[model samples]
Every structure is written in structure tokens, then in C-alpha cells.
Target chain A: MPYSVVGIGTSWGGLAAMRKLLSDLPADFSLPVVVVQHRGKDSDQLLTELLQDATDLTVCEVEDKDPLMPGRVHVAPANYHILIEAGHLSLTIEEPVRFSRPSIDVMLSSAADTYGKGAIGVVLTGANEDGARGLADIVKLGGRALVQDPRTAEIPIMPDAAVKAVPSAEVLPLEALAPRLVALSHEREKAGARRAV
Target chain B: MAVPVAAVPSTGAEPDRQSFKPDLERIEIELLLEGIFRHYGFDFRAYAYASIRRRLWKRIEEEGLSSVSALQERVLHDPEMMEKLLLDLSINVTSMFRDPGFYQTFREHVVPLLRTYPFIRLWHAGCSTGEEVYSMAILLREEGLYDRSRIYATDINEVVLQRAKAGIFPLERMQEYTDNYMRAGGKRSFSEYYTAKYGGALFDQSLTKNVVFSQHNLVTDRSFSEFNVILCRNVLIYFDKTLQSKVHGLFYDSLAMFGVLGLGSKETLRFMAHEECYQQIAPPEKIFRKVR
Candidate 1:
């Protein structure tokens, strides 16, 4: 399947894991990656700067109605829920679900709703189980679901819960996720080329 | 712009033919919005489509209706359903001193400018539930400018306006609000401003002595007055680009020279028609001074 977007959810130990995954991806990555990393309400743009340093892909904090483009990494801003729409993102200051403002579930579920089979959900290391249900939603919507192997995670609880929710999800070690995504992108490109012919 | 409708899993039917379901749903939503504007005069037609679509679907699900057209049938015929949908649409998720950093920056930057004027006029556009309005009042009081400040707090929904006028907030939220107040540089105990009554935090009435609460639709209403500062944080995110530009024009016309315009943290004046007219006063905060 040709994946259009990637929705990644993580909390505790997310920054280092994100850095590792993002740094390993090629500069010409073919999908827009939306990330929801649990952070303090007043966290600054330092996350964006740090993530940008790790990858050649352009990374920035999402604003309301910001467009989604290939090779861009859009980080959910602090103190808001990020919802996915067709070709764009929307931010809301609604009550935080499960004590998280930029709730991983909200982003991933919206991705599932908008992108359907084109959505890819990735659940990574975190202290909480926020991404479990969202990954389930993605799978239910005929989308792909991936979970970082709990044994390889810094904090395994999140990935473990995700595995429990979607047992059929592709479980990969942290080191292997970037390569898998790159391989998926190449497959998507080949699919697009086939359609063109 | 074509608002892509979310794809529903196709049943044992022609998958390509089922693609038109989203288009039909989109048309239903547009017709519903248009019907609402013509019949009720609430111009939500230009709201950010995705957010509005989510809200409409929420209302639909809550009402146990099957589709947008079904919800529209009820809303048009029944004023009560329309009222409920209005609440859902205009209910902004707001809190006292939301993004406390913005208030801290206001104290450091905007307060000094307000000191120059003998009397200050402030406008809290889309002041849902009045938390930010009262927060501003307390901030002004702490800064010794509350006596000189006149605030006009307005919203598109009258129900929220009434709630704002009451000055009662959930007592359970006080702990959170208190934390926000401290971070916003509160001078006194946050509890001193409110007393527990009616199972809620009934704030001191004096905090709103100069405040005028009214129903004013940002999408349709005209500018009422000039002001020293205008705050419409996180409110315009619901609007589409055209509506955002139009409301920005309204704010531009309403502000006096050098008046400050404060937006939500994520919002920016970039790409705005009046972008070059104002200078950003704070480095990262969305506070701007109308230079032109």
C-alpha cells in the first residue's frame, strides 16, 4: 500500500528515540510524519530545534491549519490537541484526554479517520498507554500499525500496551524502524511510478 | 478547496463507486451550514472546515442521528437542537491565564505601555466563560491599572456570554487555575479572589465592575470601539483563511495607533494582509503593536 502520512506517538524517552529514528531516515523521505511527544504545557521550540538537528527533513511545531507536505516532520505544539485532516492539520485547546494535551490517541485516531488505508501509526517508548487505542483505531481503519519492540524500548510500558492492543502490528526494535519506514517509502514511490506508466 | 471526506470502509460493493460517499457527506455539511446561516443568521459557513466537520459529526453522534442531513433536519425544525449545536460550535476550551507565559510577557511588555494612558480600554474578543477576562482584570489590579481599565468581553454565543457574566467557575478547577495564576505572576493568594458558593468558585464581583459582557459574533459582527489592547487567543484558529483575514481586518480597524493585539501562542501575523502594519512587541509571544 502507498502510505501518505505517518503518525507517531511517544512520551517518556521519546526525544532520544525520535532523534535516533529521524536521524537514520533519508533526506528524501516520501511521507509527512506527524509526531505527538508528551511535553510540558510551556515547553519551548527547543524540541523542534533539537529534532531538526537530527535529520535533514524540515521539522517544525504545527500551527492551526498547517499544511502537510512530504519530507516534513510536524510536531504537535504544547497545550493543544492536534487533529489530522486531508493534507493539513488542525490544533485545538480542548480538554486534555488522559492528562495529555497533545494526546497521542487524538492525533493517531484523526490520522486513521482522514487517511484510512493510507495512514501509518507508530507507537514508541513511553511511560503511559496513550497510543495503544489509537494504534487499534488505525488498524481497524485498514491502515498499518507498528509498535517498537518493548524489550528494546527505554520505557517499555507504552509499546507493550500497544502490542496488547494490536497484536498483529509489526514489532520492530528501535534501530530497525527508520529502515522499515525508508523501505515503505521506496515501495510507495515505486507504486506511484507504476500508476504513472 | 475540496474538503476530503473521511473514507468509510467499503462493504461488499464496488469500492470505486463507494468513493462518492464522502462527497455526498461534504455536500450535506455545506447545505446544513448554508441553511443555518440563512435561517438563524449564525455565519459559521467559513469556519475551518475540518474542525467544523468534527464538531458537526460530534453533534450528529450525540443526537443519535445517522448523517449530516439528518442532523440538519432536526436543527432547522427544532430551535433547541440549533441551540445545542451553537454551544458545541462556539464553546472554546479556555482557562484562567491560559499559557501563563503569555500573561508573564504581557506584564513585562504591555503593562508598561498601558501605564502611559490615563484610561485604558481593553477588548477580550471571544472571551468564552470569562476566565481570561477575569485573569486580565486581576492582572490589571495587581499592576494598579484595574481602576483605569474598561474591558469589553464578547462572544458569538449568548449562552457562554451569560456564563461569563456570572463569574462562577468549577471549584474542582481552582487547583489548576491557582497553579496557572501563580505562574502568571499573581501578587496575592489566588483563593482570595473567589469564595466557594453554589458549589463553584464565585469570584469577587468587583473584578468585573468595569467589564461589559455582550454577544458579538466575530464572523459577522462589526467593530464596536477602539482599544489599547485586543486579545482573541486561540479563537481565530476556528476560522478559515478568508474569515481569519476578514477578522484581522476588523481588529486592525478597531485598534488605535500603537494599540497591542495579542493572539494565541501558535497563531502568527505572518501571511496576514496587515502583517507589515504591526510590529511584534515580544520576541516569541504573539503580541503585536499596531505601528501603522
Candidate 2:
């Protein structure tokens, strides 16, 4: 798991908000992005294609055993959770946690468990507080956390929820999220490479 | 699949959120869920609020709204938005023979009891997209019970129902699922169950010969048919205590005397209403047989 996971949690106007972060990152971005957004099991997921068109990165709906790769973004495939184990995605049809299958917490926590310090957990906009505990899990596992600016988010409860749990997360606006993710990715890469060396 | 009855915790302690304060925001969340249930007839009010909070928080920032109140307003006015939120709200992640060992135990222990009955009915409650139902069908077929059993697979979300009917998964995944299928004691080549094309594996339609896919909500819908075996793995964890009890009672009523029940690894019959009612047949697999 050289350049591993960047877990993003968002809701509300998340499609547009996420595009802001994805478009800024080059297609060659060397980390896999897995996102969990609160959505209906029936809603059309154009985000994979939309993000593909919006950004230079490879975008695709995640499959049951989709291997994690750098420069690729895996959207939790509508209602399925995107989880990582032994460096592979394992989706389950388990009951919704925090009312979502692609639960932000499940994905973040799994990423922390799988990648540990190599992971970056990012919380974006939403009306509820789903990712708070997830962000905490990431931090506890030694992964860095970044929360979207509550004032700038489409919905602020999400960021506020996360902040309440862990006040030290780097809270930034949607505009600055990609830079922060990229910087975190670069630093994690060096650490990972050094460990390998 | 019929989730095995967890040992009903005698206390059925209020959903373990004591450490985390449930502020006015929490109450508002309850209200929002209640509103959704009342207006749309999808009963999410009794679902684990922790799961709801997790998903909604992300939507809040992405939607650029400040509160659940604002989110509530939009959800009420916009059917499409509400639909989107519903997709986000209901957990739909599932696969065939997920946790193969559990299915292995079902084949070894539960299938034997089912043999005594001339005909068997198995319900996969909260079936999501029907993967487990097909998994059951495959298992029953191998055990020589497919022709005698009628499997009803139900879920609240229809979107996943269509996908479940299609039975197409990434060909890339069949390797593992096939391995799981074999490890679970498949009688034939796992590939014998499906055809591979376009980088996807299309499972056999015949395996669904006895499976009836339908829509039923675990929260709002009542148990309609009596079943010989119920596999409700991983669904009840999303429910709050009261709702879990309601569901457990439904399962208790739905099951035939000495019927079999299967649940997820993390879920159990401990401290549930039916804790003493169903004796554990296999603890590791969470398989229970009704004793009373």
C-alpha cells in the first residue's frame, strides 16, 4: 500500500463540493480517493462520471474486489460501502451505519485499520454529524484529519460535529481541500517509502 | 436471510450512546427522522441514530447548509433530494456468501432441521440487493433442498432490488466469491454458477428458481409469512433497542417452532427478548434454533 487511501466524507451539495477538490488534483495524483456520501439506495450516481469529467483522475464505480491504486478515485458505488482490507476493497451489504452503507465512519475506520498512519481522513459538508467519530478514529490510528470549513460548507453540522470530537483537525475551506490532501499524501508517501527502504 | 435471534439482552440497554451527549442537535435529528418516517412512510426514526448522524454530517457540509433544520426544509420540498438522502440513509452494501463460514454453519447445522419439514420457507429480511438470497439458493440447491424451499428476499430499497435481479458482479470479484463458495462447501465449480462477460460475472438465473424478490421494510413492514429459517444478518445492528425488539418479536412470531435463525458475526441473541427462546446451534456462526 505505497500511496494508499484518502477518505472523504461529505453530504448535501457534496457533488459540486467534491468536484472542487477533485478537479484541483492532477489525474496522476498518487493516492486512491474513497468517498462516502449520504445518499439514497435508489439515487442516480453520476458522481463517478461527473468527477471523471471534472478532474483529470481516473474515476469509476467501485467493484466488489476493486484493487486500490494510486491516481484513481473509487466512489463507494452508490449503496455499497467501500472498505479496505489487506489492501483491497471489500464491500458489504450490511445494514446502514449512521444510516448509510457507504458509511463515512465505516470507510474511515476501515482505512485507519488497514493503512494506519498512511491514511488521510477528510470531512466535508453535510447536514448531520456522521463523520465526527470517523475522523476521531482516523486520528486515533495516527492518520491526519482535515475538516471542511463549517462556515464555507454547504451544510455545517458535519464539520462542526467532527470539530467537537477532535478540535485539532485542520479545518479548511472547500477551495483549499485539494492542496491539503495533496500535501498530506506527499508526506505520507515519503514516510511509507522510507519504511520500505 | 433470517438474522439469527441474538441473545436478547435482558436489559435491552438504550443504544449505547451515553458517552456521547445527545444534544438539541440529536433531538432535531430524531425529529428529522420522524418527519421522514411520517411523511414518506420509511421508518428510519428507530434506526441507530449514530449511523444517521454519521451520514448527515457529510451531507451538511456538502450541501452548504448550517443545520439539520435547513436540511429538513430542503428534504421536505425536494422529492429528488429526499430520494438522494434515502439512498444515503439506507445501508445497501452486501455480497453473496458474505462471511462464508456463517453460511457454512447454516449448511451444516440448520439445513438438517429444514430436512424434516416437507417444504421450507426462508426469509432474507433487509436483503438489500438480494445477494444473500441467491447465496441461499445456491446453498440449498447444493444441499438438495432448492426444489423444496421457497425463499423470500425483501428490502426497503427497490433500486438494489433491480440490481439483485440482474445478478451481475465484477468478474474480478468472482475469484474470491468462488473461493468463498467453495470454502463454504460448494458441490461444483463456482464458475458453474455464472457466465463471465464484459469483465463481469453473471450468476445463473436458475439458482433463483425458488427465490421471490420483494419490497419490505424492516422498520415499517410487518412480517407476513411464516418461515422455517430466517437469515437477517447484519440488518438489526442499524436498529435501536425498541425497534430491534420489535423485529426480534416479528422473527419470533414468523418462525416455525424450532425454526432456524442466522445473524452477522458482531450481532447476537444475547439480551434479546428471545435470548432463551432460541438456543445457539453454532456460536461462531451465530446460528440459533428456536427451543421454545
Candidate 3:
């Protein structure tokens, strides 16, 4: 099935990783990418501006009910939990889970629940294990789970935990992740075209 | 409104059952909401669909139920279940001096405007548990306007409204609140406003002396009074576009000329019908003054 959304979660050392991954994706990349990166509650819009400079695709900090559209990267605002809906995003100030607002587990679980087999969950480098359960949820719902190989991660604890939670997840190096996503985006389209003949 | 358990029609030969399930789930949710509205006086039929759906599923999983329809049956028949569900839906996450920058902006820009008036009437709509209301009271007190200002703090849930009236908060959060206070340009030590009692930080009862705490449903209720300032931060985010427009109209009608309005940091008056009527006062702060 064609994936509808890509939910990414990261924490410490995430900025560099996210910059690399997002910078690599082409301008016309078909899937809508939503990211949850743990940051200080008072952090400014520097992240969005920096990402916008790095990628050709439009990058924005999500508001209350922003639509999930292609050719855009949506970053969760600080101090709110971002939940995935059918074709849009909703935010809540619900108390943080595991002492983390903008919790990866909450976002990924919502994506899994909403998109089912059409969701793609990616867990990158981080010091905490916030995204493991979320990645597991995505896998349980027949969605794809991708984790950075611990050996290639800036901080391996997060990816290590995710690997433990969902061993069947595709583990790629830091440099390989963006390419894999690009290939996945086109794989379905290529298949559809083939069947049409 | 009594929907049978087997109301979800079985899809026969759909090639994409995955896609069909969400549509069926949407129908089940609608029926459940309609039943809740008919059985209970509370109306949530116009809430933001995505947020409400997430909250419903949270309650469903907590109760060990599989579907919205199952939860709806219990909610309609059992008053206790409805109370729990109501709390889940209405309890908003808030903090004292949340988005301190917004409060700072209010002090700098809105305070001067308030000084020109003889008396200030402020409304804190959807004041969850009273943190922001207390925060406002303290700000006014520091500003030397507390004597003439009356705050009407209202919420849809009576449970939270009572808590807001009590003026007690978890002591563990005092440190964070103090930091927020300092950032919001508080003039005095934050600890001076509250005493440690009742297993929490009990705020000075005098803070709420001029404040009226009451239960008011923004969704179904009409505006009760005109005000100089209307603070409905983050409350409209729970509403869909149609409901949001309706509430905006209510606020517009309720505010006197040149009244100030404050919203959550991420919220905007961009597409509302009254967008042109209000001029944004603080750049990027979502504070607006009724101009037209």
C-alpha cells in the first residue's frame, strides 16, 4: 500500500540528523513528513528556519489544525503533543508522557492508529527511548518502521531501544535513511504504472 | 439515538478494507456523539473532529472497550461513566504564566490600555483549574489595578471551575511557576502570593476576592456580559472552523470598543470573519485590539 505519512522522532543530537535527512529529500517528495524533536519549552523558531534553509520543500511549525500536505515538513511546536488525524494534524496540551512533551510515542501511535498500513515511522538518534513504543505501534498496525542503526547513530540509546522494541524494523545508517524513504515513495507508483500495462 | 451494536455495515467485496474501516469508524463516532448530546445536556457535537476522536479512543482504551459505540452506551446509561468521559474531553493542559512572553506582552501593551479606563472587566473563558486566572490576578495586583478590576473566570466543567475557585496548585510546580513569573515581568517574589498548605501551594484567597468563578459552556451558552478584555487562550483550538467562527462572533459582540483579546501563542485571527475588525497589537503574540 502507498504510504500516506511519515512520522519522525528524535531527541538529543537530532538537529544534525534531521538536517541531513530533510536536506536530502527531493523537492517533489510525495509523502508528508511530520517530525517531533524534543526541545526546550521556550525554544524559538530557529529550527524551522534552519530546516527551511536546508531543504527545498516547505518547512513549517505546526499550528492547531494544519493540514497534512505533500511537499511540506511539519515540525511539532514546543510544549504540545502533536497527534495525526485522517488528513490533518491536531495538537493537545495533554500532560507530557515520560516527562516529555511533544512525545514521539504519542505522535507515532496516533499516526499508526490513523494511517494503519499507510504510515511510515522513523526513529533517529537520541539519548532517550521515547520513540520505541511508537515505532512498535506502527509495526503492529502493518505500517513500516525504520530505525537508524545504533552503530551509525550520534547517540545510540534511542535507536538501540527502538531496535529492541521492533527487531523487524529496517535499520539503516544515518546517510542511507533519506534515500530509502525516496525509494519507498516511488516504489508504489512504479508498481501501479506496471500493473496498468 | 439508540444505535444498535451491529450498525456498522459489513463491507462485502471492497478491495481496500483498510481505507473503508476509518469511514465506518467516523460514522460510529458521529452516532456516539449524537447519543451523548441527546442523553446529556452537554453539547460537543461541534468540537474539532481529530482532537475529540483521539480523546474518545483514550477513554475507550482506559475502559477496556473496543469501539466508540461501546463507550457511548456506557456513557449514556451510566452517569458516572459520563463524568469520567467529560473530564477526559474538557480537561485542558495549562500552566501558570504559560507562554511567559505572551504575558510579558500583555503587561507592556495591554496594561497601558487598561490604565486609560476607570474600571477593567476581564473575562477568562475556559479558565481550566484557574492557573491563568490567578496569574492574571497577581499581574493586576502588581500593576496597581487589582482594586478596580473584576475577573470573571468561567469553564464548561464544574469540577475544574471549583478547583479554580479554590486557588490551590501542586507545590511541585511552584519552581516552574516562579521561573515563569519572573519571565512575565513579575515585580515581587512569586512565593509571597501563596502559602504551602493542603498538600499544595494555596494562593492568597484575596487574589480571587473580586473574581467571580462560575460554570459557563461556550459551545451552547450565550455571552452574559460586555467586557474590556476577553482572554480565551487555547480554548478555540478544541473547536472546529464553524464553531470557532461562532465563538468569534460571540466574543466580538461581547467586547466593548477598543477591547483587547488574547489567544494562545499558536492561535491566530487570520481567517475569522472579524479578522479585519481587530488590529494585532503585539507582533507575533496573537494579542489583538478591536479597531473597527
Candidate 4:
């Protein structure tokens, strides 16, 4: 709650991109991170278990009416949307977006509604441009937005679209993302104070 | 940020537009939103472009333009056209007593918490033309809480803000609004609240005595006031989810402790970091009270 709420969207090769961000944040550091990785509907394998192994931050699949906590990462589950309202979180099997559940755009826009500048959007290696405009909204509300360097990304379309939609975003390579994440987390704490002012 | 007109062939050629040329179109929107922000200060750089694209393309089709690039040129030259486009793109379609159940539920479910507060500041975010503001005012009046409340009715579009200020609505729409008003628990006939003029009904200004209509954008703007209740409905669906959370943060910051947050029926506490901060006052209708 004190640090930034980062929303990352990656389609094809997203998990690796997020792992790069997770490995960088210190254990004591407190930022709530939410991610929307396009999930296939019929796949039974749990994404949280998969992502938890990749990050030091506790990765958990979101549930209905779950409270968003600091120092934890929430991933949208398959066949549902992740929404933040009045500070509590909700996961709904409401509708599909752009042909996928756990839509990057749905999570991103809802987060933009909730966090404003407290939200930070990161677009990782992915094939589609689902989160580009939503990430642009993050920047519009004075939140930080980052795109992984497309050239180095295993799948670049997602990051490339984000860069194209949001021209002012910070573009960094995968290796550089972790330290920047830490710095951004700190900057957000200050902004939150300013916001409360 | 203007592109060469030469790159777009002059008007009078085939109306070669089913959709935009993908590559050129993609970059143009980024530039266009930037140009608007820099020149006009109405920041739309963050809206879900897919939605904006659909809206703008509708404008392009109506005006018989070839490309979004072509539409951009006209938008730069014609402020009136831009205003119309702003209305089309930004000022949402609103009806009186929209989600009448939301209001009914607010009276039963949320008003008790409201009654506990002393003087209250309610922010009607995205109060398109003030229909909901009047609706809320009427509700508060019925509950004997009207004098204790001040409603800030805000929207990104100033044109609609003026309409909201006027408190007038098309007379033709009254029949439907009356039904909605009844659903929202209006004790008196809705016609008693407005006077007919200019083929429209100018709603009674008394309902808006405690209201302030202003210009504010959820996309490119910051929080302006601390409020006891923040009502933003049907607006977030146009945004991608990330933008939705940022807007939520602004609302969260703008809310006082134990303030109420009302979202559209479809929108709710999901995926946002502050989900624990509010308790549901009306779960099915999506009205929530900020707990944290």
C-alpha cells in the first residue's frame, strides 16, 4: 500500500519478463504488484504456482473480494477479470476481452481508475498490444509506465505497441528493469505522500 | 506534430476507408493525443485507444474522411469540430435515473452511513450533463439530507458541463426519465421538478442549489477535492484496466476516511491494490464505502 502498484501485461513470453522485475525488489520492500498474462481458458495448470517460483515476491492468483496487500503480487486468474474498487479487489468471470480471460486491458484500466499515479504499468515481452493504451492511461494520470526494450524481448509486439501508444514512457532493457523498479517504488511512496497532501 | 498533408492524398479520391492503415494509424494516435495535451491541455493520452479509435473512426465516417490522419488535420483547424468530437468521444451517453436500482439501493443501503456524517461533500465524477446529480439531489431531498450535502458535478468536457449547469433536458426524454425517477423512488411526479421552454424542460434549479459543476478529466487530471462520496459510473469501461486503477487511486486519494465509492454495476473491487480499503454498501449495484 505504501509503494507502487505495478501492472504488467505480457502475452507470449511474459513470465520471464516479470521474473526480471521480481528478482530486483528487496524482501523488505513493499509494493503491490498485479499482472495480467493472457491465459488460455481450458488450461488447468495454475499460473500463480508457476509465477511464484519465478519471483521472490509472493505471487498468488487473485480471488473474489480479496484485499490487495503490499509486498505481494496478484495475478489475474483464467476466465476472470481483476478489478480494484474502494481499495478491495474483486475477481469476476464477467466477460472476455480481446479473446482472452485475465485481460491485460481490463486489469490495466481498472487499476488506472483505482491507483492513478500510484499505479505503475510495465509492458513485457508479448506478441499483442493489449496493454498499450491502458499503460498510456497510467502515464496520463501521472503514474510511471515502462516498456521492455523490444529488440531484446523474446516477443516484442506488446512492448512495441506500448511504446507506440505511450510515447513518453521509460523504455529499458530487461537487465535494467529491476533497479528501475526499486527506484520507481521509492518515488511512488513520495508521490503518495504528496497525493495525501 | 502535424504530418505532411501531401502524404494523405487530397479529398475527392475514392473513399478508401474501411479502417485505418495499421502502421501509419498507430503512430498517428500517439502524436495526436500528445498534440492535444500540449496545445489544449485536455490530456487524453491515456484512454483506451481501442475505444477512442472506435469513437474517432465513427466521427471520421460521419464527416466522410479517409483516414484518422485526415481527421487529425480537420481537428487541428476547427475548434467547433473538436468540441463536437469531444462530446462524441468524452461526454458519455447518460440517462436520468440510469441504474435506478443503484439509486434505490443507495437510499436503502448507503444513506444510513451518509446520515451519520455531518456536512457531506459528494463528487459526481463524470457527471455527464448532470442527470445523476439531480437524481442524487432528489434522493437526498427525500431523505431530509439535502441541506447537509454539497455535490460537485464534474466532467472532462466543458461543453457538457455547461449543459449540466443549465439543468435542462430534452422534453422528449422526460417520459423515460419519469419512469426512471419513479424507479429511483421519487415521491412526486418528475414533471413537478422542471419547467418547459425551448422545446426542452429546464429542470428546477433548486435541486442543484448544493451542486457545483466543473471540468475534470479522469485520464489526464489529478484529484481536486476530498469527498465523502465519489460516484464515477460507466466511465471506466472505456479505459483499459491499468488506466482504470489509476483513476481508482485518484478517487481513493480524493475520498475521506469511510467515504463511499460508487461504481457502475459492472465495475467492482477486483485486481486493484486498494480492494481492502472499501466495504460493499450495495454489492449487486457496486456501491462501496471506503474503510481504509
Mind giving the per-residue lDDT tens digits that candidate 3 earns over B156-272? 999998888888999999999999999999999999999999999999999999999999999889999999999999898888867888999999999999999999888878678
**Candidate that would win on TM-score:** 3
TM-score of candidate 3 relative to the true fold? 0.92
In model 3, which residue pairs have backbone atoms overlapping below 3 Å? none
Tens digits of per-residue lDDT for model 2 on A49-159?
787788888776765444565667778766566565434455555557767767888888766655565567999999888888888987876667899999998889999
lDDT of 4 at B268: 64
| Per-model TM-score versus the true fold | 0.91, 0.60, 0.92, 0.57
What's candidate 3's DockQ score? 0.30
C-alpha RMSD values across all candidates: 4.4, 15.6, 5.6, 15.5
What docking grade does candidate 2 earn? incorrect
Clashes of each: 0, 73, 0, 51
Here the TM-score of candidate 3's chain B is: 0.93
Candidate 1, residues A1-197, lDDT tens digits: the string is 66778899999999999999999999877678999999998788999999999999989899887777677899999888898877778888877888998999989988776777677899999999999988998888787898999999999999999999999999999999999998877776676667666
How well is each residue in B1-292 modelled by candidate 2, as lDDT tens digits?
A: 1111111221111112222333566777888888887888887887655456656766777799988888888887788878888778777767778777788888888888888889999988888777788888998998899999998988888888887888887777777788778878778888888898656788898988788889888777787989998989878766765687889999999998998888875465656787899988976568888889
- Candidate 1, residues B233-256, lDDT tens digits: the string is 999988887789999999999999
Residue B162 C-alpha lDDT in model 3: 87
After superposition, which runs of candidate 2 have C-alpha atoms over 4 Å from their true positions? A1-197, B1-22
Q: Which ten residues in a row have the lowest lDDT in candidate 3 chain B?
A: B5-14
**Which candidate order results from sorting by TM-score in descending order?**
3, 1, 2, 4
What fraction of the genuine interface contacts, i.e. the true contacts, does candidate 1 reproduce? Answer: 0.16
